[model samples]
Target: MGGTLRVNSLAIQDRRGWQKPYELTGRLVGIIGPIDRGKSSMVDCIDFVLGRSVRFKGAVDDQLVAVKAGMQIGDEEVFLHRSRRRLGVVRVEDLAGDEIATVPINASGDQQELSDWLLARLGLDDAFASVRLPHDRRLSFASDLLPYLHVRQEDIDRFVIRPQTSADDAARLAVAKLLLELINPASERLGARIHDLNNEIRNKQRKADQVRDFLNASPETNSGTLDADLDRLRDDETQAAQRLKSLRDRARAATQFAEQRQQQVDRARQRLATAEDGVDWALRRHREKATALAQIDASLAELGEVAAASSEDRERLALLYDACPACETDLSSRAVPTGRCSLCTETLPGAAQHKEKQQLQRARERLVPEVAELEQNVTRARHAADLAREQLALARRAVDEDTADAVTPYVDAITAAATELEALRSEITTLERLKEPHRRLSERQEEINRLSEELDQAREQQVRVGAELNEPDDVLQRLNNLFGRVVSEFRLPWATGRARLDRDTLLPMVDDQDFDQRGGGSRTAVSVAYSLTLMMYALEDPTRFQLPQMLILDSPQKNLGRNDHDQDLATRIYRWIIDYFEVRREALGGRYETFQLVIVDNNIPTAVRSGFDTLIQFKDPHGFIRDLDHPHGEPAGYEQLALDDELDHDGL
Candidate 1:
């Protein structure tokens, strides 16, 4: 059983920035007013605020920018607000009007959406339903239940249980099953598991098919030959490995021998470089000695020329000093001392000159022997250079001979071995590449087998859980009787007092005739009866059902005429509602205590007006938007309606 959801009030903000509040706290709340008075619009506000998808258009809807509802679920009091500008989010507030959390309108991930939040409060969070098939299950959202809870005027005469097209037919049935307690969490979980297993099996089978197709596309390989091919390839691989190893062994021995010969060649090259360097050094030393000897000879010749010049100069100076040239005085008879200068009458420089000549003579004597010794050394150095050159030539020849002997013979053998090994390895690699598709095919087949086993187990579990579904036939029988009784009261023209709910369609059938075969008014009567019957059934055992104790019907008297019979039927419908609420209240507690009903219509019959707990009425030019000057057309400054609403409710 879920907690009771009592809608306290609905507030609509219009383009004029005015919030029109309607109190819906009464058990039997009726919004009765003339046509175009926004009765349906008010119901839509409740729907929109409760997280139902509604396309807002037309005059009054265009003027509306936001809708808010204050509600009490169990012991919690909260306000839910939805803005037209922001379509996907609903703002939830606490009793103190403080913002608590913003929840998404639809289920997104693990986050609690508006539907889940409300369902949690109602103790129906675990309720689930299937859309098209029993296995295709999903959590039941508020929208799934809204079609049953709130019946629009247009749908009242057109549908028996809202056909919901092909997509949502299963959801419609699942909701009925849930309300009737024919399905529970355990059965739903098993069904969902079966659905998941089926999906996994399909996926695995698809992969297996793809792998099989790939294997078939290749003419040389298939699943049957995969093992044989692998065996042959492995044997060939082993032979190739052995051959490669033998080739490597032979190449290794040859490489060792070559390395030894290379070492000899390296030593010979080193010897050749040393001999060349020695030759160069010897030649350079010979040239240096020859140059030094030449320089010594040149110095000796210069010393001799200087000594002869000094002697000639001394003789000429002595003759010139015989007469003084400054005054033409001949001073040749003036006897100058041997160590005096004749011109200045000072000591003569002859002693210094003679000592220098003696030193020069001594140097020439020493240089003469050294020159002879240097000539001998030059000859020896040339001979040594010649010997080094000959040794260098021989060493180079030896190196060339060693290189030719070491590498040329092995080149062809090593290259042939390497080429053969590469070809063998390449063939092995190609064989391995050809084996890949077979491996994947095997893996995919294994997966398909595993998934098939799991799917079988899941199906067995589904059957076991499905067997536990309680009294589906008994529930349908009870519902059929309840539906017949409610339809009988409506006095529908097609009623034969033997009406039964169609088991498959879950719709009312009169005298074995389909619901769609009836007239408009009769259809409307059956639709209203069907909705009322569901509510009555839920009320019969509140603890066993998760349906909220609320029902909102818009214009149940939609197709009825102004005739006496038609009016009488309309009055009976209202009276039935009023009487039902009265019975429940008296049986339970006070009015507006247990179940809540809100009816939107053009007018509530005068006879049953007093039976309602709350009746809201609007006159001409007045509607849900009480202060709207223009109800059917765009008002002034309508473009700013959303902006004005945002500015006014920004704090909220």
Candidate 2:
């Protein structure tokens, strides 16, 4: 008991309900119960608590909360508690109930804490993280190794540890690698190194290609003819410089002539200004004089008409009688006075009237002379204005003609020289830009030279590593032989004509027949033989094996005990495994530590049950879930309650 490393017990607890704690224990524990009685549930709970990678497909009660398992790895006893409420979290504790660690089962690095702790307890080194052989992902998790410890009912017919239905082909290859690495840890290290080297080689090759592409696309520059090209460019530059200087000298001379023409234009503009002012003044004077002359002539004509009417009025007055027509007064002797008309009887001063007529005639005569004099002055002013205008026009025309003759040649020379210089400058800029690609080509060539050297060294290293990557064939052969011998010892229906395990498939082969061709019973027998063979091989060298020396198989009796013959064969198979363990112990002179085997089935043969160290049986409604009022292994007290109720009815 002290030497053996095995599970001591598995306990299920429901703190929220009336269900009591149900526990199963011992090395060869047989949980015998009928179908749908929580038999498979008990197996699933144990697997869950142990962190096995099997899907739970068993009965679950709403009241169930968590499951706990206790196992002894070597000399250390540990407890694992897994809560159904928190499916992936596992809490580890010592036998004394001290918390050792809490692990979350996830696909992250922190989740590996549980796996690392478990491997330490099982006396194995920590598996490298994310290390894989070719064509496989990293398969170093603690759960990844659980397949070897437990024989899952769902994958019982499968050849490898996990079923092809649940696991892919890559997982099977990983299992083979895991086995080989267990025998030779160097293979794992070598594989990881080889993977790194391959990546390095690819990365270097890509860089080299990039450099080569850059070199290939480089623009060609004729360095051998560079001197001749430069000499030609220098000659072009010299000719351009000389032409530019000559044009500049001519432009300076023409600029001086244009300045002289501008001076002439300025003088002409001044003269035009003076002439325009003079013409404006003269025209205004002429208009004022003509208006005066017109007024004078009108006054002279009016004076002449007034003189004639006055003469006629005087003659009539001399011939008329000296009486007023209206009064008929006898005033013949009263003469018509000078200031008064004779017919009106009002007298005026004759001398005064005559003087007024004389004054009128004199004023008319003086205006005519003044008008003539002003008209003569206006004519002279007009003649002088016309002469000034003619001189201004001549000056403006002379300025325009001089500007056209002198400035136009200088403007044309400057434009032609500037256009030629701009074109030459553009050519020089294009030549400068073309040289940049030549510099880039040299840089790429240097990079390619350096990378080529490194590539050669990496290739040599990769080749050496590849040579060491020989397949682990010898150890696989030994494993196959052991499995074949175990299959033969069981003597199942399919175990005939030199039975053996196929190295590639990891399944039993009877002569040339594969495990898939066998009947269900034959396969079951062969599967059990293989499971036993693995445990035996691990126990032979526990230090080198990564699998724990414990196996939990659920419901092996389904195919094993379908009929009388199968039942007999199953009985023999059980005895054979037990005897195998006993022989190993005996061979070691009681020094060998036997491993654990937990069998869960509905039918446990009476003889086989007797040899088991622990036996738990399910009957009636008394299962892992116990009734609150009526516990297991005890009859319900309903009869007593009914009797008391009857008495109360009769008033007892």
Candidate 3:
């Protein structure tokens, strides 16, 4: 058995915003509240943070944005966070706030990333990663053990595990085997050895099946003729290969000559295309130059007319007045204008006019040289265009001549040889296809032999493990002895007379009836009794059980509320857990805390409530999400209507 899991606190927060963590503490924690006061939700929060497979129910409401929890598992602490909107995502963090890992919460079977990670971090042995059951079935710890740790309210009437499918039933059995192993090291070793042997046997069986399928898919073979047939096929393949090699050698020289001629033709074609492009580009440049020359000539003509008009205007202005154009006044004889023309604002200069005319004449002279250069450029461009066109034509002629002489004959010859080569390739393909069945027949026979040998070895090992498995049932007997005492004390009434734990189901059988068929009160009593027995057995000998040493029983009183006897039984169940811890602590002299038990329910007897180490009461406005106020009045449990059982089915 493992040491007790003393959960110091469970701190939950909304990941979307900064809310104070809803922290609950103590070894014997009791979530006490009225019906629907979020007691069940609190239990869910604890289970979720500790890696329970079922989704937290009552805690996840529409107002809840996200759910995150920080908890101490034994001595190590970890933080878990999940979004309400995205149920499948979860993030885990260390105490220092470093992200440890994030995983999809609902990963498929055999893809248990988050579960496996948590299992490793919880310090569980890797050997427990997978467990084998009878009929060659295997179960993952995530799907089996975690569910059993926290039994649901609806599942109280069911067995230790409420399996929803056949696969789940097998997983439950595997979990039973695992629990048994914890109490018996001999059983664990034998089980592990047997599992490994079974795995090897399965592998061998698979190979044998594959070999049989391969042989069945192909033509039947005679062992005596196989070698002879292979040799004949190999010889034919070799002869065909040799003929192919000879043909290739003979064609090599001509093929190389053809390739060289083709390369020459390709180069010629490229050069011709380049020259043609050059010719077009030069022609375009020549046309542009000619247009530029025409524009220059027109610009010069416009400049000459503008100059003549300007000279006439200067002469007329000089005759008009040496006057300012601002005001009309006669000042023809004045050196400087005193009166100005009323129509225009100007101070006319006689010497400056002649300087402007001289500047125009200089500009005209510059245009004449530019126009001549453009004409010369146009002529040069035309000549380049003509040379490029001639070069392109000459190149085309050379390519045509090469094609007519060297390339044509070789291309015809190569094409004929290629056709013949393709025919030989087809023939080779047919022969290989014909040889395939024989090849498969030989390989399958070899595989069958190998598998047969391995299967024999696996069977021998399995038998050895079986012998080891049969050594003794001392540990099981010890467990049952404890279980028997607990059930007898609980006093679950059966229709027949006697009640005992079924060795196969690991559940209580009353009067040869299954646990699920019993009355609600009896069922609840047996369930609690079963849990207490497991704790008592492990606490008696910590080395014998690998349970986490913590049990979370949610709303056990729901199904046991009908009569005083049943209620008394529920009270006893709670008192038993608290008393067991107290006695163990006293005996150990405060040296160790060996077990922790949590009971979550709407109703807790006053005595039971007072005796607990910790109590969290949800009343009035205070509930699961402490800060957020509920809008639809008081958050009430579904007391008015019958609630369906949440039978969570983990499937393949």
Candidate 4:
């Protein structure tokens, strides 16, 4: 709501070559193309450049390599590029083509660098949503909103945000709540705090339980006997310490050598303890490095497997010649060309395969250096750990030799007193060790209480903040009104005036049935209506909603039949979108310049073609990539002429 994200242009580069730049800056645009003409691929470039993981179809995946988009985010203009040659990175550049930043793409995480940059520009950098639980939340990402903003053809006949699990559904709903202003930032922050408190309290409780179980299992010590045992050991230690002082005085007069040896033994024991700690620390570091190396190796293996599988699939598709495997179309009239695809009649050049191999090589090159570095670290850590263990052994031997030398000189004289004193001191040390568990248990319980109180306070504050926000009834009512209007205009058989929005699921409901329970055509109508309603509601009060003023619907007429009634319904749907655009354009006057809509379908009715500001149509044998025939890498400009003619026909 703070600003808008507009795609000004997009350029796609495949194995063949770069396509003509698509001018996408318009209030409304329609991408019309027959099947396999790369209509969806063109739209997917926008999504992929904007930070979405899109897996292109069989041939498209094999041929496509890179995508770049020029975007205007409010007052800022930037160019974004994503390439198959570079793994897990996106290149951001300024208008002058100077590098702005290289953002890393985390394979699995809500806090992505590119998503953060995009969300920050839209004033939603701090947005969050609850996932499995109310307190368990994750940051809202661009991918989370892409499903609603760009409705794919495959998803148009399902719910607006088709979730795979209950947790996914909850997360999507939480995002909706944030956009609708039903959940405020204060509440979200408090929820995070509460979640942290919960984890801390549980950890403390677990430690306390372990300590309690230890005390209970011990035969000589327990929580009830710790204080008594400590007091008894203290009395015995005092007596033994006095006797040892007397014995030391007598032994000092006999010889100073024994006293010096005893001091050496004490120093050696301290060194031994220090060496033991060093060994532990070095070994822990070694284990950590080894684990990291293992993870990197696993990643490299997975990347290799995926690349091999994709290449194999491409090869298999290339070898199919009996018939058009995809559509089973007869190829009897087509001559068997030496180096061309039977389906699309496009040239199959060896340079394209070489380019794919180069991409894989580049991706591997990026990770190989890191793997080598990790291997070196692991080897160095292991060597350090071994050296530390050797030092520990030397320290242990020194302690034993010094102890034996110190005791042999005055063995008979002080044996009875020294032995008795040693026994008392060892018992005291053992009792002290047993008493520490009680102290730790008490501390852990106290921490648990403190965290519990903080958790309660955090929950209370969250509740108070949530109560202050307005109910979403008004928003739901408005959505239902818009949805009903769209459904009626589409003339759905079950389009009763009583169509309402589900309070829990936020889905359209007719005759007490949810959108998912309806037929394919009805489901498509409901899904489209839901998206349009949300966009319209955001446009009405942009300040209250966080939704961007853009919508891209892919093949809204996908499942609709070819009958006259279905044809009229599809036409009416287009008309409704046109009318809504015109009304909003007049209402906002200048502010509506940011609003953009893109519809991708196989065909568009001639009557509504004039309503769009831009039209892109692709004929057979030509698609988003048009340089498939050039073995010497010459640009094919025929597709550009076709696009220009289509635009001229639309009077744009």
Candidate 5:
């Protein structure tokens, strides 16, 4: 089966997994399926052919897997491409439609020449890296460049570039622009030379002025005096510089010492604070314990009094029991001494019974004193906790006093106006320590001219620092450099460089400008524009991206919402992509060769659909895909889940 060029068509061989091998046709293709229906998987399949793992949810577990795809560009048909394996074995048909050349997925080790070849052919060799997404973290690639995404969110602001971003991100953007600019040999070579020559001119002029001024001002200008004076002054400057450096080092050390000491005191104070709270809690517990002890003691005291009185009472009662155990006076006292009348004399059982009762009473009486002692102990614990709290407070106070001494000066300085002399002192100290001390320029006219002339020379000297910014290196060599710098700077993928290119050499960016109501959509459009622009430039070189010679993006509108202000952003994305494609299309030739695009979406501006060669709509899948020719015609063993229902947490 040959590939489909200029159009995307699907031919599925199996439906084993969501990623089951299926043929896709089109340059700009959109696989319209609900999220998780394997839209990204198609992209992964493309990756697999390039010797990359098929990614799933930002994870790559199937590195061993391969993707199978077929393509037809114009009259040429290509087939049997596998991921990573035998990738370059299948070549792209050349411009003539009859010629063939092998293509590499990526270049390695001194493979710069080969990469350049591919990039040059694809129009991408010298393009910036691009932004590719599965979902979430639109801010991720921005991190590589700005350190802050927007101008307003930084730790400090020069027109804040939003927070969580930095100048590093701006550098990435610079790399992107520089990449595309360098693709035009004239632009690249001339830009670099202009930079160098400009520096050179300035330096020569400065040197010329210096020699003229010296000749005019000096009397006799004794060669020896000039030489000696210059040498001595240099030495003096060097020594002063060294002293300044030493003082700075000492100051830093002092600051560090104070900080460490303060930190220690702060930590101690925190501990004391916690201890004080604990002391309060302990005191409360102690109070409760003391109250309980007091109650117990009172009960014990009552028991003691009861026991003391009970002893006397018991003796009397004992006699009463013996004299008349029933207190009945033996029903009438012993004088009436009839054995029957004498209290129906049951003798109150034997002495042994009385002994048992007496022992029980004695045990109860003894508990009072011991209980009182325990209560006293609880009272003592309450007092001890109170004392501990006071001591902890005192310790905290002492730490505060000590820390206050070290920090007070800085605190006062900070609280006062920023114009304190200390601020100037700090600047002076820093400069002195860094001492490249041609810093002091004398104020007289002679000095001003001299310093200004010297400034030109210093700038010229600085030119030896790095590679000329713009040079016509081999196309892919330049691309790699551009992509590497862009990627490293923004921490984004090299492929995403396509998003940052421009047709008119103008740069697009977001800064302190007022935005429309559609924040999400506008941001998304900007992101898409940047990504798409870079790709368009890449496609200009046949040596870069491969055939089918075009790329398509779906739902660049994914995160946009149509607020009053943001309504135009979505429309802008469509118009921009269309305009970009249109421009590149004419440059390539009226009949764009080996390009296919299939965009699928339910909710996007109508303008996007109308601009495409074909706009397609298909009924929703309804449920899991089923094989038309199969037993029972059901989902086989797999079950369709209620996607929106509450999920089971067991495995999770």
Candidate 6:
């Protein structure tokens, strides 16, 4: 089907500091600038225009580059302006200009008139609406976008390849698979072949019965070794599959145990950090109180001494003497200015002494009262200090940072649970993966015993005979080659990625195989490894995909695989992702219609960037109304955002 996407135009509406609108044209898409020039974040603006249910996962402190997407559909040049809302609004161009009609996704209507009319004319499905705008947000959120549209990554696989894996599998599906299987082999006269086989078997049985009657008197023939051989063959195939199954089950259990344990450890760490913070807060409060109390005591002591010195003497001294409180001297006399203890002297100028005596009495009154108050305040300060010290000690003593509790039990429980789940998943993965060998074993077992007995009887009867079994073509070699090509220079511990061809089954089984046979730990580890790898594998091939092509990876490179093959595989695994994209584009005419890869850039392959259609360096710079040319400097190149006042309205 022919497809087209573009942003027709934009208008500048600068409001917030750096935010302005730019008219974006989708057809003229290309990388904008050098790495540091903010070429990576340009897509965020497209996302903003798409209604932010698909906003960037986390927070960004600054404004981001913003642009509104104006999409023009095919032939009629159908115009639709979508600006980040539920279902975009549609418009029809008439002589009057673009006229707003119904919603794009049709919230109120049963079907969108705009979409319906467009698809009907184009001979496409209703799904075409999903691809209309192709906002950067949609590009980044392939995973989340599934529910909004019927377009699925694994549709071909589920419907055409492995229908049985899904609930949709049924007798009808089996019929379809059978038809496809026959078609793949270029089978002719399959209908006639079934009829012929049934008739021939009947005839053979009838002829053998007639011959036995005629030779009844010859001898009673009983082949003893034949039966035993047949039994042995049956038992062997079942046993191998069963052994593999058992080993895989144990492995799955181990994986679950590890996951649960890790979760427990995380919780415990959070709890420990919280408890420690609480203790620190209390400690700080105690220290603050204790220091304040000490300061209070020092202030009290100083005030107490001044008050106790001599309130009566200070008042008397002010009148005449003005002597120092400690010295208790007189400065009333002009000649010497003082006498030792002037107030206490027997011989004196009696009337003059009266004035100095009065001053001393006033000083004593003020000093005595203040000293008593100072003594009370000191007592209070001492008590507060003691209490603060006691509280501080209790807080220090209670903080048993090391002895409180261990995350061991929680981790162990989590580990055990995770281990169990892991084992189950491993067993499941292994059983599912081993389809080819299991099928072969079943067919071989059925024939082995019968043939052995035939050989034995022939040795006794002097005849050699054999049975025939249809040998299904071995696609293992082809599968491995496909995986290797996809993996290219990958690095990860990988047991195997396989594809088996079977008339009874649909789609090739991928992921950890023979896990049960592999030890418990190995099986469990392989299950996890294989599941992830299979997911990666599917994503690599867009045509066979069931999920989004975009990848949201965290720190997955840490301790990926331990064994020789696994470790070696881990080294090149990430690079394989790049290769997968490259191959997809090469195989098809192009790359994913819309795909995104968000990750913590570590150990990233040097060549991976080429696969990325756009690199969003997530440092969020500016947002806009999508008017590219206005007053501000041109950001990401769309002519400068021009002001409305700058437009030549007079020409109109």
Candidates' C-alpha lDDT: 0.72, 0.61, 0.59, 0.73, 0.41, 0.37
Ordered from best to worst TM-score, the candidate numbers read: 1, 4, 2, 3, 5, 6
Please give, for residues 1-652, the per-residue lDDT of candidate 6 as tens digits: 2222234443222234334333343211223222233322334333333333234321221223223334444334433334333335433443335565544543344654443544444333322222211122111121222222211122211232223333333332322222222121112123223334445545654555554444343322212332344455455555555655666565455445345445545555555555555555555555554544444344344444444655454322333345645775643331222222344443333234445444444544555555555555555555555555555454444433322343333555456555655665565454444334334444554455455554444443321111111122322233344544443233223435342322344233334333233443333233223323433433344332233233333223333345655444533554455565456556753333333333322234344445444333323232222223322354464688666763657552
Q: Which lDDT tens digits does candidate 3 get at residues 231-280? A: 66566656666665666565454345455556655666666566566656
Best by lDDT: 4
Q: Give the per-residue lDDT digits (tens) of candidate 4, residues 434-547.
A: 777777778879879988988988988888998876578877877788777776777777566667788887877776787778899878877888888888878877877778
lDDT of 4 at 524: 82
Please provide TM-scores, in order, for all candidate models, with all chains considered together: 0.61, 0.55, 0.54, 0.59, 0.33, 0.27
The model with the greater lDDT, 2 or 4, is 4
Distance from true position, residue 386, model 4, in Å?
72
For every candidate in turn, the CA RMSD to the true structure comes to: 15.6, 21.4, 18.9, 39.4, 30.9, 38.0
Writing each residue's lDDT as its tens digit, candidate 5 over 293-406 gives 454444445434444544334322233232455453422112211111224443332222343344334444554455565556556655655665666566656656655655
Model 6 / residue 597 / CA error / Å: 8.9
Clashes of 5: 73
lDDT of 3 at 627: 60
For residue 324, model 1's alpha carbon misses the true position, in angstroms, by 80
Q: How close is candidate 2 to the true structure, as a TM-score?
A: 0.55
Model 4 regions more than 4 Å off: 107-112, 128-142, 198-445, 467-470, 627-652
What residue runs in model 6 are displaced by over 4 Å at the alpha carbon? 1-67, 70-81, 84-102, 110-492, 499-509, 512-574, 577-604, 610-614, 619-652
